[model samples]
Target: MTTTGPRVEEGYAPVTGGVRMYWRSVGEGGPPLVVVHGGFGVVEMFGDVLERLAAGRRVVAVELQGHGHTADVDRPFTWEAFADDVAALVGSLGPGPADLLGYSLGGGVVLRTAIRSPEAVRRLVVVSAPCRRDGWFPDVRAGQESVSSAGLEWMRRTPLYEAYAAVAPDVDAFPALMDKTGALISGDYDWTDEVRALTLPVLLAYADADGIPPAHAAEFFALLGGGLRDAGWDGSGRPASRLAVLPGRTHYDVFAAPELAPVVDAFLTAGG
Candidate 1:
């Protein structure tokens, strides 16, 4: 399948929390949609999705610290820290809340940002990210635990590394990014309570065969008032939350699925 990325207007969002966050924007008119990429990922990873989403509205793609064009800092990498950076970036953009869409590691950061600065997010879309560490499959959890900087040599041959080499501000810092990301993923965490209390609308999209267990995804939807009682003819029983399990997709390719952008646009555009 051939996919083309949107033309972007890129710039740095001045140093905040000791690291300068890099961002790029595409499209015109309509509400802004902040797109956050996954772990060990750059803005290019969402190239196709951004291209599709940008067709109807502004899409702002951001690269977190130690990834892509953003440089590393002394502070430890944590969801809270990433959330703060996103919030700061939104604040710098000017007034009004922007919609947020995140995939994998970026999904967790977006969730935390919604929780940390509720006023900054108009809507939230989390793709393939679990609210708790244990939500992932056992093998996936084990793999995360064993990840370390020692795999740098192996990673050198990966497309992720190649992509980084092409655009990262400091290609030499790839190992550091991997180490910090590993540490973040290895840590145990749970945000069920916060998620359950969220007031803004949320759309939880995941691949049917995601790294996270399907059971966990259902559980998360339950937290959002989904899978409860059946909706009446008028559909009053259903919560504002939405969920979609894309068929024939995996954790790695869900973000690139041709069906995703349209579904997301429908959800975001539908009135509550």
Candidate 2:
């Protein structure tokens, strides 16, 4: 893929926890969509995929707490903290109930945002994120668990490092980013109750080959009141929530999957 990112108007919003979160905007239409990248990622990492999502409406992409142009703060990484920051930024943008899309670590953050501040969100798209830590395959969970500064020396040569280095305020903090993210993902969590209570429309889209098992996805859908019974002739029986497993995608590259934008766009527009 050509990896051409969108041309954005960049800015920052001083959100919770004394952090000035960095944000980039594309398009100029109403009711913006907020896009959050995976851990150790910057906005540009989504490349043209984000641009494509911005087709007719605005897309606001954020660099959370310590990633990319956003500098790290004194606080440790926590889902609630990040979610509050995101919620604050969403309100700052306008009197919004904006559409939200998040990938990987971002997915967890937005999930909390939708839970904690449902009024601030209109529709949600969760890509490659698990409600519980164990929702991930044991091997993937092992990788997340085993991450440590000492154990990640080899990552200096990977795209994760290069992407951060390109625009991070403190490039050397890559290790710290890894450390915090490692600790964050390594923690135990089960958000089933919270997810089951969400009243907003959610699109639980993932790669068919994702680290999260298909059974887990079905369980998540069922929790959202989906897949329990048949949709009648007019599809009225289908749950408000939607589930998609895009073929040929894995957790690693599903963010930029070609099939992603269409479903997400359809879900967002369909809400109107």
Candidate 3:
């Protein structure tokens, strides 16, 4: 059972906030699968994992504004705006029922997109997606300040970090970068009741050793179920939502984990 690995195709779309997104597509073009990169991620950061999962279908890895090689936008960071940008990109690509997958910040965008247009998404996979549960952060404002002051060198030393490093000399700016990202993350984004209405297939993957604990992942799954049950959907013992913990993985490896490939392959195959 050999697979035709992922390939790359350039993609660009303009959105509000004057942001122009740059994305790369891989695989052989079945039902479109869009891969939204994390806040601090670039297109090629998830190359290994995306390529493997994209073996049999089209996989689009996106680079949001101010990340990777994408042009920086003048507006402040907001997941709603980012999600809208994704909506525009996905809308421009082709048609309905596309697979929406997001990692970290990207996952937040995917969740919002699924809620925004459930009809457009066939399957949703959110890897280490952050949520705004009660006490989701510790003095988020102060946390931003701390991360900004410490910079990427400090992040490199901690197991809590999950974003990509700068490819140039501006690595010193990571603290501010992370601070801005954190501010946006801690803002108004909340998956509490929004994602529960989605009836499409949903896969939630979190690392056993991730910064956001597996308990949080389970809680997210439970909350999702509660929401769906309230909406009179299939929120019973056999529902469309699932939560899995990747053994021996951390925040950064949640998406890059080698084990992810086969699991995703099986899931997509079975779903199809």
Candidates' C-alpha lDDT: 0.90, 0.89, 0.70
Q: Where in model 1 is the C-alpha error above 4 Å? A: 1-7
Indicate the worst ten consecutive residues by lDDT in candidate 3: 160-169
Cα lDDT of model 3 by residue, 172-263, tens digit: 45565666676676565467767555677788888877657656677678766723345345533555566678899876777888887777
Give the clash count for each candidate. Answer: 0, 0, 0
Q: Write the per-residue lDDT of candidate 1 for residues 1-272, one digit (tens) a residue.
A: 99865567989996467888899999865578999999888888975788888888889999999998898999889999999999998887778999999999999999999999999999999999999999999999999987778999999999989988999877888888888999999999999999989999899999999999789999999998888889989988878889999999999999889899998998889893
**Regions of model 3 farther than 4 Å from truth:** 1-6, 133-145, 149-179, 226-237
* Model 1: worst 10 consecutive residues (lDDT sum): 6-15
lDDT of 2 by residue, 53-146 (tens): 8887899999999998999998899999999999999999987588899999999999999999899999988998988989999999999987
Better of 2 and 3 by TM-score: 2
Could you tell me how far off, in angstroms, the CA of residue 252 lies in candidate 2 after the best superposition?
Answer: 1.0
Task: Output the TM-score of candidate 1.
Answer: 0.95
TM-score of every candidate relative to the true structure: 0.95, 0.96, 0.80
Evaluate model 2: give its lDDT.
0.89
